[model samples]
Target chain A: MTWAAVLLLAAGTYALRLAGPMLRRRITLPEAAVRYCGLGAVVLLAAFIATSTMIDGTRLVGPTRPAAVAVGAILALRRAPFIVVVCGAAVTAAVLRLAGLP
Target chain B: MRLIRRTVVLVRGAGLLRDVIAVASAVGVVGASFGAMAAAAGVAPELTIGMSLLVFAGGAQFLAVGVIGAGGGIAAAILAGLLLNARHLPFGLAVGAAFDRGWATRIVGSHLMIDESVAFALAQREPERRRRAYWMCGIAVFVCWNLGTALGVLAGGAVGDPNVLGLDAAFPAGLLALLLPSLADRVALRVALIGATIAVVATPLLQPGAGLLLALIALAFALPLPARRPGRRP
Candidate 1:
C-alpha cells in the first residue's frame, strides 16, 4: 500500500511538473487561471504549514509547534538565512516543550 | 575546443555557481531533516530514502510522511503530495523558455524543474546562461539532497528521539520559511493568510488532508475575470 501510494504520487507529481515545460507553447491556461498561478504556491505552502503545525488526528496539537513555527516564520520574514530559520525554530520548540508546555 | 567552451562557460558563471552551491547545501540539510523525520515516523530507512529519491519535492515528502504517519490512509497521502507539488506546474511554465529545445532536454529538464533551479535559471540575463545555471543547480541539488538523505537515515537510528531536538517542529518551520518571500506580495499575503486560517479552522472538521486541500479555494481572489474584448458586450 505504501509503495502504491508513493509510486502514484511520484507519477502524478512528475506529470504536473512536466505539463507546463513541455506544453507551454502548445497549451495555454484560461486567463483567470493564469493570473492566479503565482499565488497557488503561496496558498499551498500556507495551508500545509497550518495543517501540519496545528492538526493531528482530527485534534489540534499543542501550541509549542505553532509557536516554534511562528518564530521561524518571523525570522524568515526578516530575511534571515535558511540555516538560522531552521535552527531557531527547532530551538524554540525544544525550549517550549522542555518547559512542560503541552 | 569543446572543452575550452565548457571552461569559458564555467568561468563566466562562477558567481552563479557559488550561489548554486550555497542553495544546494541548504537543500541538502533539509533533505537530511526529511530523512530524520521519516525515520522517526517509523518508516524503514530504505523506503525513507526511496521517498526522497522519487518524490524529490521537499514539502510534498514532508507532507506525505506527516499524513501517512498520522494514519491518514494512503489515498489521502497521495492526494496531499499531488496538491503540494502542483506549484511545479507554474514553475515549469515560468522556466520553460530557458530549456534548450529538444525532446531529451525537455524530458530531463522537466524532471529537474524544482524551485531553486527554476529561480536560478530565471535570474540569469541570457538564454545560454539560464540553461547553464538551471542544469548546474538542478544537478547539484539532486546529488546533495540524496547524499544528505542517506547520511540522515544512517544517523536517524541512533537519534531515534527527534523531539529532544525539536525536529518535529522543523517541518512546519521550514515550510514557513519558504513561504515568507511569497508573502511579500500583498495579494499573495492576503490569499495565504486566508488559506491558513481556513486550514487551521477546518482541520478538526474535515478529514485529514482535506483542510489543506480546501484551503486552495482561498486563491479564488487571485483569478482575474475573463478578458473583456474591446467591442464586445457580455
Candidate 2:
C-alpha cells in the first residue's frame, strides 16, 4: 500500500514537471490560471509547513514541536542556511522533549 | 591568451559549482534524517531508501512518511506528498527553456528538476551557464541525497526515537527555509498567511491532508481579470 502510494505520487509529480516542457507550446495558461499557479505555490508550501509542524495525523502535536518549529521558522526568515535551520530546530525540540515537556 | 580565456570561464562558473556542493551536502544531511525518521517510525529500511530514490523531493517524502507513520491512509499520504510537490510545475516551467534538445536529456532533466536544481538554474542569467548549473547541481544532489538516505537507513535502527533528536522539527524547518525567500513578496506573504490560517482552522475539522489542500483555495484571491486595452470599447 505504501509503495503504491509512493509510486502514484512520484508519477503524478513527474507528469506535472514534464507538463511544463511538453505542454507549454501546446497550451498557454490563462492569465488567472498563471497567477493562481504562482500563488498556489506559496500557499501550498505554507500549508505543508503548518500541517507538518502543527498536525500529527488527525491530532495536534504538543507545544514543544510547534515551539521548535518556531525556532526554525525564525532562523529561516533570517535566512539561515538549510543545515543550520534544520539542526537548530531539531536541537530545540530535542532539548525540550528531553526536559519532559510532553 | 586562450588559456587565460578558459581560466576566466572557469572562474565565472565557480560560484555555481560551489553552490552545487553546498546544496548537495545540505540536502544529503536532511535525507539522512528522513531515513532515520522513517525507520524509527517503523517503515522498513528498504522502503525508506526506495522512497528517497523515487520521490526525491525531501519535503513531500517527509510529509508522506509522517502521514503514513501516523497511521494515516495511503491515499492521504499520496495526496499530501503530491500537494507538497505541486510547485514543481512552475519550477520545471522556469527552467524548461534551459534544457537542450533530445528526448533522453529532456526526460532525465525533467526528472531531476527539484527545488535545488531549478533554483540554481534560474539564478544564472546566462542561458549556457544556467544549463550547466542545472545539470551539475541536479546530478550532484541526486547522488548525494540517495547516498545519504541509504546511510541513514543503515544507521536508523541505532538512532532510536527520532523525535528525541528533534528530527520531527527538521521537516518543518527545512520547508520554512524554502518558503522564506518567496515570503518576501508581499502578495506571497499575504497568500501564505491566509493559507496557513485556513490550514490551522481546517486541521481539526477535516482529515490530516485535507487541511493542506484546503489552503490552496486561498489562491483564488490571487486570480486577476485580464486588463482592458487602451482603446477597448468597454
Candidate 3:
C-alpha cells in the first residue's frame, strides 16, 4: 500500500509539473482557477499543521507540542532560516517535556 | 544562436554557482530532517530515499510521510500529497520556457521543476539566465537532497525515540514554516484559519485522514463569487 501510494504520488506530481509546460499552448487555466488552486494548497497545509500539532491518534496531546510549534511559527514569520525554525521547535518541545509540561 | 553564445560566456563566472550551492545546502538540511522523521516514524529507509529522489517536492513529501506515519490510509496520503502539489501547475506555466528545447530535456526538467528552482529561474531577467538558473538549482537540489536523506536515514536508525528529543514537534513546525509565506495573503489567511479550525474540530470525531480531507470544504470560501450582477445594489 505504501509503495502504491508513493508511486502514484510520484506519477501524479510529475504530471502536474509537466502539465503547464506541455499544455501551455493548448489550454490556459483561468486566472481565478489558478488563484484558487494556490489557495487550496495553503488551506490543506494549514489543516495538516493544526492536526499534527494538536492531535495524536485521535487524542489531543498536551499543550507542549503546540507551544513548540508556535515558537517555530514565530521564527518562520520573522524569516528565520529553516534549520533555525526546526531546531527552535525541537529544543522548545524537549525542554518543555523535560520540565514536566507534557 | 547569439543568445546561446552569450550564455556560454556568462556562465564562466562562479557567482551564480555559489548562490545555487548555498540554496541547495539549505534545502539539504530540510531534506535530512524529512528523512530522519520518516525513519523515526518507522518508515523504511528505501521508501524515504525513494521519495526524496522521486517526489522531490519537500512539502508534499513531508506531508505524505506524516500522514502515513500517523496511520492515515495510503489513499489519504496520496490525496494529501496531490493537493499540496497543485501549485506546481502554475509553477510549470511560469517556468515552461526554460524546458522548451527538446523532449528529453523537457521530461527531465519537468521532473526537476520545484519551488526553489522555479523561483531562481524567475528571478533572472534574461531567458538564458533563467534556463541556466533553473537547471543549476534543480540539479544541485536533487543531488544535495538525496545525499542528505541518505545520511538522515543512517542517523535516524540510531535515535531511540523521536518524542523524547521533541523531534515529533519538528514535523509540524517545519510544515508551518512552509505554509507561512502563503498565509501572508489575506484571503489565504482566512481560508487557512477556517480550514485549520475544521480539521482540529473534526479530528477526534473522524478517522485518521478524514479530518484533514474535510478541510477541503474551506476552499469553497475562496471561490470567486459569480460576477456581481451589473445592477446589483451595493
Candidate 4:
C-alpha cells in the first residue's frame, strides 16, 4: 500500500514539473519572486538538513559519529567536492575500523 | 546522435563533476539521514532508492520518509510532499523563459527541473550555457543523489545505529553550504537568517505538517515582497 503511495507521489512530483512549462502562459511570477524561489529551495534544503542532523528520531542528539563529523567539517572548511567528503568520511570510518575504534 | 546530444546536454547541465561532488557529500549525508528514518520506519532500504529514482526530490522524499516514520498515512505523506514541491512550478517556468531552445528542447529541459538544477540553469546568462549547464547539474545531481541514497540505505540496513559515525551532525554543515551562497545581499541574508531563526523556534512546537507551514511563513517573510525587479528581461 505504501509503495503504491510512493509511486503515486513520485508521479505527482514529475507531473508538477511537467505542468510548469505547459502553463507558462497562464501563470507568471515576478523575477524577484522567481529568484527568491530558487533561494527558497536552497533554504528549504538547508532547513531540512539542519533540523534532521540535530535531532535523532525521538531524541535531541545521538552518540558520537566522529568520521561523519570529519566529513561535514571537510565539506565546510575546504568546500571540498562531495565525493571527497564521502570518501574521506568513509575512509576515515574505514581507518577507525582498521584501528579497532568502531 | 540526438540521444547523445541530449546526454551531453544533461551532463553539461549539471555543474562539473567536481562541483557536483562538492555538493554530493552533503547530499549523501542527507541521504544517510533519510536512510536512518526509512530503516526505523521499517520501510525496505531498497524502496528508498526507488523513491530517489522516481521522485528524485530530496526535500519531498525526506519529508515523506519522515512522515512515514511517524505513522502518517501514505496518502497524507504524498500530499504533503507534493505541496512542498509546488514551488518547482515557478522554478521550471523561470528556466523555460530563460531557455532559448526549440519546444522539444524546452520540454526536455523541463524534465530536469529540481531545486539545484533550476538554480544552476538560471545562474548562467547564455542560452547554450544555460542548457548545457542546467542539464549537467541536474544529471550529476541525479546520479550522485540516487546513488548516495542507495549507499545510505545499504549502510543503514547493515549498521545498527546511524549515530555510530556522527551522521547526525551533518545537517547544519550541509544547510550551511546551501545557505551561504544565496546570501547575495542584505535582504537575502536577513531572509535566510530570519527563516532559520523561525525554523529553530517552530520545530518543536508543530508537528511535521505545521513545521513546514512555519518554514513557508518564515520563507515568505525572508523573501522580498513579491515586487518584480524593474529591468528583468522577459
Error of 4 at A62 (Å): 6.3
Model 1 regions lying over 4 Å from their true place: A1-6, A29-33, A56-58, A79-82, B1-48, B57-105, B112-141, B152-156, B168-171, B174-178, B207-209, B223-234
Best by TM-score: 2
Ranking by TM-score: 2, 1, 4, 3
**Which DockQ values do the candidates obtain, in the order shown?**
0.49, 0.50, 0.47, 0.31
Taking the tens digit of each residue's C-alpha lDDT, what string does model 4 give over A1-79?
2679778988888788877666665667765656666556554544444445444332344323344544655675576
1 versus 3: better lDDT goes to: 3
Determine which window of 10 residues in candidate 3 chain B has minimal summed lDDT: B222-231
Candidate 3 lDDT over B1-234, as tens digits, reads 999987876764365676577567756766777788888878888988988888888867877887877788788888878876766775676677777677888899999987667655655667887799789989999998899888888888553445666766876786576557567767788888999999999979975457876887998876663443557877
> Per-residue lDDT of B31-120 in model 1, one digit per residue for the tens?
777777787888888787877777788767877888888898888888877876776776676667677487788888887877667656
Interface RMSD of each: 3.8, 3.9, 5.1, 4.7
By DockQ: ranked, best first: 2, 1, 3, 4
After superposition, the stretches of candidate 4 with alpha carbons farther than 4 Å from their true spots are: A19-25, A28-46, A49-102, B1-15, B25-49, B62-66, B90-112, B115-133, B147-156, B159-175, B207-210, B216-234
Any residue pairs clashing in model 1, and if so which? none
Instruction: Pull out the clashing pairs in model 2.
Output: none
lDDT (CA) per prediction: 0.75, 0.75, 0.77, 0.60
Sorted into a CAPRI-style docking class, model 3 comes out as: acceptable
Candidate 2's DockQ is 0.50
